[model samples]
Target: MTTDILIEHRRDIADLKQRIKNRRLQVLGLFGTPIVLAVVLLVWAGLKISFWLHSDTPSAINNILGGVVAFLVLSVIVQLVAEFSEDFDVWRDRKTSVRELNLQLSLAEERHILEARRRTPPSMDRQASYKERLPGEIARLRYESQHYRRVHLLMQWLLFVSSSAISAVTAWYDPPQPAKGVLIGLGFTVTVITAAAGYFKPRERAFNLQQTADSIEQHATALELGIAPYNAMEEASNLELFATTVEGLRADQRMREQQLDQPQQGQQHVI
Candidate 1:
């Protein structure tokens, strides 16, 4: 199915869900008044019974109680009748809507499955698969590397500036109690940020990721242009060498990641 159809189905599902929710709320409201009135009627009846047994009660009060009980009883009966009259139709329509929503959800899932299968690389044609996947892989790695690099740089700058500010504030200004407290808090912040930066090693991660991406791109380019290691061999052999080289680079990158994740005694370096 086309993406548009899947999107439309999703929209339909959402609309149906909202309709169902509104209908349920409406049904609750439709029945709620009668229940409340019934409770009121019961309370009034008890009051009426108590007043009837008392000889000192006023007749006017008895009349008012009788009128209120009658009104509550009538209101409850009317509300129940009206609600029951519409309940069956409302429930039937909601049920139909729910079924349609389920069907639409199923169709949307099927569309997603089909899209995934369409994008799956062929197992038999290794070269074709590589061509289909390498560019995207390279782009993703480069993007992540750049993201890490930017974060690392920002954290480093923040640490430097915060440290300098804390130093200047302490040495030059005695200031107020609140200002001193802020400086202390800033010092704590700097320490935490520095520790976190050291632990995460974003610089090392960025370097390794960028190197791997660049190495993969280089191999791909050489294979495409028929040069160096790829230039002297048959197409299949060249493809094999290219795949092995790329895989090795990826493995090395993974190893580096594992090393970074592990706590070391001293400073960690990218292997």
Candidate 2:
């Protein structure tokens, strides 16, 4: 019964979130149209004024007056369309609906949290949690890997650009004192960045981390589908094998990280 209720609460939360998102879009459209229209009108007015100022034609003033009248007529038509398109009662009740949705969503979330906490002790399913967490772990590792890769590339490009600038400053032309100082600053920056990059080894870290994440994800997928080694085993044995394989992969990754953390000579000794 508690599980069923929790399921219902989960469904309700999802539905509420979707509904809230749709309402936000609707509100954006409702307000955005007027904002866009106003901007367009301002631009039109500015253009009309500019043209009138430069024009020698006597009919220019009359044309401006006609444009103003047209604008007023358009405004009225737009307002009337807006009024007719939506029910006044619905508009008035929108705030109430928003409040109710927020309250219900909050209540549902609270109930879900309470139920989850109550059930957590009795349902201490480590294997279930581990399986559930694999995808998230994979995602996090991939994201971190990509982040480190970007930083590595950025630092490399900065180093190259700074070195090139230093060369150009010294070889191409004799720059002023301020310019020379700036060039010297760039050289310092390059040196510092190079040292940091060498120390961090972002590229190698990214590669190793991504490789580990991919291996883990692949093994998890194979385990789930019962392919190859997993296929030959019973369910319990398959799960044990999967856990052992994943842990072994994780241990290898940790060893790689430890190696990366050490100095070059230390790393060589370890290897």
Candidate 3:
């Protein structure tokens, strides 16, 4: 039973991590393309600035260079449609629901085991019960830690791409009135999106979840191997102590999870 639970959790984590890896590559390409073009624009600006400083440059050559600059600015819009699509929202939501179910199940089983132990003819099943749920908790935490780590990075890149694109477009060229208006609109859009991503605080949440997971793994590993701290005395004593430790960690984790879930009170996350 423990083996099966471990395998299922491991499988789910592996699947989620692979999907995150794939999405990271796709997003990096999408965002990187704009930065690459922006670099090209900066280089173009450098040349323009260099020529502007050189009074020895011929007028006709300078005129040709000006034409090149305008053409490049117009070309940026073509590259903006570097179209790629991934249904991240759908997959992330589904995985979140699965994880939440696992959490609820873990908590429920824990309560059931407690109630059983308190009965008149107390069942000697606490150890067995804890052993059953430990694998799932560990698996879920591992997945969540790594998942949030990916989300933090993806948002950072997105913020970079949008901000860099805005700077490159407005700073490097003087567009026509309508195009300049679009430039301002683009700046506002980037600001809003970047703000939204940052307001979620994915980086801090990722770190917190990762730390909690590592702490839980300490208990999980000890319980699994019957090691010291948890290995003292009889089997009942060991399992009872293990359950206490697990409950503490579970409470801490649930509080952290609750904090992460509080979207209305400014716990919003892009991932």
Model 1 regions lying over 4 Å from their true place: 1-124, 265-271
Model 2 TM-score, all chains together: 0.54
How many angstroms is residue 207 displaced in model 1 relative to the true structure, after the best TM-score fit? 0.5
- Give per-residue CA lDDT, model 3, range 57-150, as digits (tens): 5677657666766665654443333331232342232223334545545665565455444542433474667668777877787788788778
Q: Candidate 1, residue 245: CA error in Å?
A: 1.3
* lDDT (Cα, tens digit) per residue for candidate 2, span 57-83: 356655775576676667655644544
* lDDT of predicted model 3: 0.65
TM-score, every prediction: 0.55, 0.54, 0.48
Summarize candidate 1's per-residue lDDT along 31-111 as a digit string, tens digits.
675676667667666766776556555677667767876776776566455546654453434323445655756676676
Select the stronger candidate by TM-score from 1 and 3. Answer: 1
What lDDT does candidate 3 reach at residue 187? 77
Model 1 lowest lDDT segment of ten: 87-96
Order the candidate numbers by lDDT, best to worst.
2, 1, 3
Q: Report the error of model 1 at residue 95, Å.
A: 10
- Candidate 1 residue 165 Cα shift, in angstroms, is 0.5
